[model samples]
Target: MAEVLVLYYSRHGGTRKMARLIARGIESTGAVATLRTVPELVVAGETATPQQADDPFVTLDDLKNCDGLAFGSPVRFGNMAAPLKHFIDSTSKEWLAGTLIGKPALVFTSGSMLHGGQETTLQSMMLPLLHHGMVIVGLPHSEPALHSTQGGGSPYGPSHITSESRRQPDNDEKDLAIAGGKRLAMIAAKLQER
Candidate 1:
């Protein structure tokens, strides 16, 4: 089966949760979604710590081989988390090869406050993928939740803004994430079949 890579970096688990929901949506389209997380970067001579057992690190080959992509991260001051940035920075080889060219892609993010830069973070994540010549797929206004939700859905992409003190994805946000994933997968599948 074709696989869509659901790649993310989540420090407090909120972004991870979003990744899972997107993966579910991808699978619902009958395309496989491979969940991969980046390991925390430890500087040389700094203490190396293990990431959570379940959140295994992503390798560059995973990025190169996936049929499509769904990237998620926690908002870090109006941007994606540093760890995810670091991972993307290491993908120059793929960029040079144009390995991701024409692939379908989607972005998702989790933020602490309703205005905590969710849209900006989603846009920020798109920059690198755009540079790779990947085609971006975002939430369309056709999704009723995008119009009705008071929080966290954007035409740029799906997003989650945490209202509670603890950052977590709400139901509407998850629905948007999944919807975005499904949209991406459907586009990719059609392109592949063509």
Candidate 2:
């Protein structure tokens, strides 16, 4: 089966929830979704073990092998959180090897407020994927939820407005996320056939 890696770094569970919803969308298209999370970055000389949480730590192999990618992160000051960035920065080897070239990829984020830089954060996450030559997948205006969402949905990607709270995403947000995943899967499958 074609496999799409749903990789993320979530704190306070909002982004993690988004990742699951996206994975559901991916699987609805009959593609296998491999969900993985990265460990929190530790300071040098610190002996901290990474937390597994709902998903295990992601390895480079996951990036190299996946047919598609859906990346998620909590927005931090108009950017992805350091943990996810740290992980992406470590993928120079993958970039050099061209392992992710031509794969379809999407990005998602959760922010504490409605104006909390959701679009910018999603764009920031796409940078490394673009460098790796992955095709960035985004929601089009045709997605109905994008027209009426009071919470979060964007042309850039699916998003959630957490208000910095732990509440679950609204229905509109969920629908957009699922749609984005399914779209990514369909595009990936088509590309893989080329």
Which predicted model would earn the best lDDT? 2
For residues 28-128, what per-residue lDDT tens digits would candidate 1 score against the true structure? 99999999998887878999876664656788889877989999988999998888999999999999999999999999988778888988999999999
Q: Which residue pairs clash within candidate 1?
A: none
Estimated TM-score per prediction?
0.93, 0.95
RMSD of 1: 1.9
Each prediction's Cα lDDT score?
0.87, 0.93
Clashes of each: 0, 2
Q: How far out, in Å, is residue 135 in model 2?
A: 0.2
Which stretches of candidate 1 lie above 4 Å from their native place?
43-47, 163-168
**RMSD of candidates 1 onward, in order:** 1.9, 1.8
Instruction: Name the 10 consecutive residues with the lowest summed lDDT in model 2.
Output: 160-169
